[model samples]
Target: MTASSWLLVAFPALGALILLLAGKRAKAWGHLLGCATVTLAFVYGVILFFAADTKSTVDTKLFSWIPVSALQVDFGLRIDALSLTFVLLITGVGMLIHFYSIGYMENDEGRYRFFAYLNLFVASMLVLVLGNSFVTLYLGWEGVGLASYLLIGWYQGRNSAATAAKKAFLMNRVGDVGLALAIFIMFKYSGSTGYAQVFDAVAAGKFPPAAITAMAILLLLGACGKSGQFPLQAWLPDAMEGPTPVSALIHAATMVTAGVYLVARSREIFNATEDGRLIVTLVGTVTLLLGCVVGCAYDDIKKVLAYSTVSQIGYMMLAVGLGPVAYALGIMHLVAHGFFKAGLFLGAGSVMHGMNDEVDMRKFGGLRRKMPITYVTFGLGYLALIGIPPLSGFFTKDAIIEAALGQGGWRGWVMGGAALLGAGLTAFYMTRLMVMTFHGKERWKDLKSEDGRDFHPHESKPIMWVPMAILAVGSIGAGAFFALGHRFTEWLAPSVGETVEAHHLPVEAWVISVAAVVISLLGVLIAWLVFRRDVPVERPERVSFVTKAARKDLYGNALNEAVVARPGTWLARALVYVDNRGVDGAVNGLAAALGGGSGRLRRLQTGFVRSYALSMLGGTFLLLVALLLVRFS
Candidate 1:
């Protein structure tokens, strides 16, 4: 590694520190500084992406972090093809978000604090991607979680914002426990938690099958919590309480993807355990289907996107379970999703800005005439998300489907079928969102304000528009990289050759691609027919009970409250009561008894020198008589 690699981490951290220290007095400068820092980091990322040897690890040790008799850890950076790809995504897309935040948050009261948190988020994500050891990676992991909580709750006055932040933090702690446990297990089995050493041990088959499976599954638990998979997914939909830029950052760019990154990083161990792989596939399938179902029910624009994030992450998880080909497909999807999702979020933010904070699609209409830039960019993003042919999502989603089908069994068909259905739902909901929000007549009728002035909507400033344009371009064109899939295979050949076979079946590829396009178009047509002709937003409520159940996420929150929250609360209360009444009461009672005995003894010694002397004399006379009697006997 070179000095440029260190710059990637240092620049953003320094920017965050500067913005934090300067406070609101330097708000404009802070935004510029933040954008500049990420821009520089992105440049370095690109340089490294082209210059570095894709097959080898670029290691740079900064210093010794922990030294002990039993363990040692170093602060180091590793740049491989996978890490480099993620770095580019984080920095490149991160710069766009930062640039967009400049306009999105221009009028906010906590502008400086917002920029500070944004820069800190970028710094922590860089640490997460660059770290060479599990200890370092975990440090960055928790750091990003903390930053996410802070950003999500930036509007401290709002109770919902604080609640969402707390939920995100608490849910992530569940995953953190699994991650920490997995680290301990890895150390116990491999004697080292460094990525290099751990991979070496696994390759040599030093660990038992049971141990490997346990570690992999535990790690998957962590992935589930962080990636917003089922059961732990409640926090994400609520996370929309934050600023829209923050939603773009956390949900689209940085925080949620960490779990997928972790699983992909630990692919060797996961591949060794069939049970673990099956669990990953099942979870991905369920999350994919569930997200698509719930996303269709919501009218809140950002919430729709949040559920879509869950659904897309499900695709990434599915890719991981399919082995190496699928793993790369997952990463590919991650990158492409970052582009379009971030663009979609920013577009939503632009809409909110135009409508004076109106987020319900029912209240918005004919926005295509008012905000053409946002409409075009967001429409392109939606198309990409729905996996239209020649778009980025198509290539990545196609790769995953092909990998699943190649497995050639009922399992493959099930997972592949679920993914195909998810694609259709993605198209339907996104199209519904578009037509409802942009295609109909203006729906905002009431214009009541304190000043009694009429409300009018307008477009966002250029700062926000430019970033959307850049991301929209990426969403349309980034899939061209898949045309060089053979090259990618060659580049990754050395690292994953043993477990993954290289095969390109033209018939399989074409079939999956054609099927995806057909399903997507079907969804689009259904949405267009249902929503486009309707004048006043009348969605039919006559649906099956099972459909309604799926629409409400199967009442997941109720189940979580009953099964997880209630038991956890009761256990906590029981422990607290025992500590206060049982343990503390016993200790206080013993102290009181000892004090009472001491008081009695003090009274017995009460203030008489003559009494004390007489007692001593009586004791001496008794002792002498006893001694004389014993001698005579």
Candidate 2:
């Protein structure tokens, strides 16, 4: 079993390599190969999960990866509950997405290449979760970044896709720097970057509290960047410029969750630093609100869902920020989110497929009759996302809300209130999405698409809806299955440790749950009352200040430009000026002076013998006069 661990990553990686190398030869079967590889990985992971005693850590040492002095790193796999949980999510959902993409991208000429990139992404994500050391994780971290850049920019002809890919890549690099620096610090202080070594050192109080706090904060910075949290979140919504399947894969299953995984995996570091934990909590709270508020204003189906992903991930970050008491809960939300969010995205894809590839929800209404499978599946996912009872989100999300309120005091009230408010807003926007797209009168009846095509709504083929149906089922039941009898927390205890539930709550647990349900209902009611009447195909020319702000993503991009981008650009230009004028001018001036002095000296070097003879005679006479005067003195 230890030796076989490598197969987890090997399968998809092999598939990707073959797809790329075989080129046109593999085009006929490329999508099949991609789906088969992920399916095989899922099968292996399930077998491994049931076959092994998950209560303990399983480290499979392949070889010495880095054998530097005092820094011995092993190329190994970490097989345990946490890693396996992500493995299942990635491969299982990845397989479905791969299958869905077959139908989604069937007519596209580069479908084979697209599948190869997907396979590579899956393999990179596996490496990220399964690696035993930070360096190995970084290797996969970079690989995921590269694969996402490729996949997001898959349509090279579109400037928006290309620009969005670069934006996502650059923003993530800001966070990756934090992660890289934290690893360097870990190596410097702990003398090792492997999980066990650094963790053991931390447990022994080898690192100072300040150092620990720094590490935790740095890691959080990276998490925020990858997860689309505050100040680093501007890239995610724009990333919808990619294909719908790419959006589903990145937002739901793999990339966005990487931040949560990083935090949960490093629970020990966070547990040691109250300041770090508090800052993380604050960032999460702010981000959730940002995502929710902005989500309410978007007409583009994919961007709305993208912001929803941001908001949901913010919930997970908040849960984990509460420390051990909610680490498993955060992860639970992540898993639940993977199901419902993926379904939502795929459903959006279905809507687009039938509606002339149009993304504007304003152009859609009463689509449920045209695409019943999509409507049913999407509705289930919507219910699950908004915390409707007995759905996955009700089980997972309410737990997080309960955990927040349980923290107690002003901190509890503030965070818990913020979370509840976010919940309400989440319901509002999602309901708005549903009401505008599926509940109201058909808005596209007399309208033509931006591409001047007729609207002919139809159901997607089984190849696409089958995956949505599966994900919808998961969206409905996965939360309950993971939450029942404390099973998820217990299963995760071996890796993340047991979370001691906060006992001194400001309010009863049932109160939080009831309040959450009421707020969600209220949000839904308000959206129905407002949007169920008529949503204009064109945005209103005039709106309130708040509405305008929300539409602008709360000025997040502008803030980034003002605070980071424009200043950085100016600084770069300033640096170039200084290099040219200050540094180069001095060197050039010195060269000019030497050249002029050489020119004067060259004049004395006359080619004529007469000038040489005269110069020699004058030199001899001056020497003789100086010698005579010295003798007289």
By lDDT, the best candidate is 2
TM-score of every candidate? 0.92, 0.97
Model 1 C-alpha lDDT per residue in residues 1-633, reported as the tens digit of each score: 453587898989998998888887776677888889899999988987788887776778888889886788889888887778778889988999999999999988778788888889989988987898888899889989989899889889999999999999998898889989999988987888899988889889998998889988889888888889887888888889999999999877799899899988888888788889888888988998889988888788999999999999999898887776567778778988999999999999999988877777877878888899999999889988999868888988877777766666687678878988999999999998999888977766553322454447788899999999999999977867656565554554444432254254435577778988999999999999988864454445898887688667678878778988899999999999999899998999899999999999888695799989988999999999999999998
**Residue pair clashes in candidate 2:** none
lDDT of each: 0.85, 0.92
Question: What's the residue-level lDDT of 127 in candidate 2?
Answer: 95
lDDT for 315 in candidate 1 is 91
The lDDT, on a scale of 0 to 1, for candidate 2 is 0.92
Candidate 2: tens digits of C-alpha lDDT, residues 344-461: 9999999999999999999999999999999999999999999998889988888888888888887788888999999899999999999999978898998998889889999999
Candidate 2 residue 512 Cα shift, in angstroms, is: 1.5
Give each model's clash number. Answer: 0, 0
Candidate 1 accuracy as TM-score = 0.92
Worst 10 residues of 1 by lDDT: 497-506
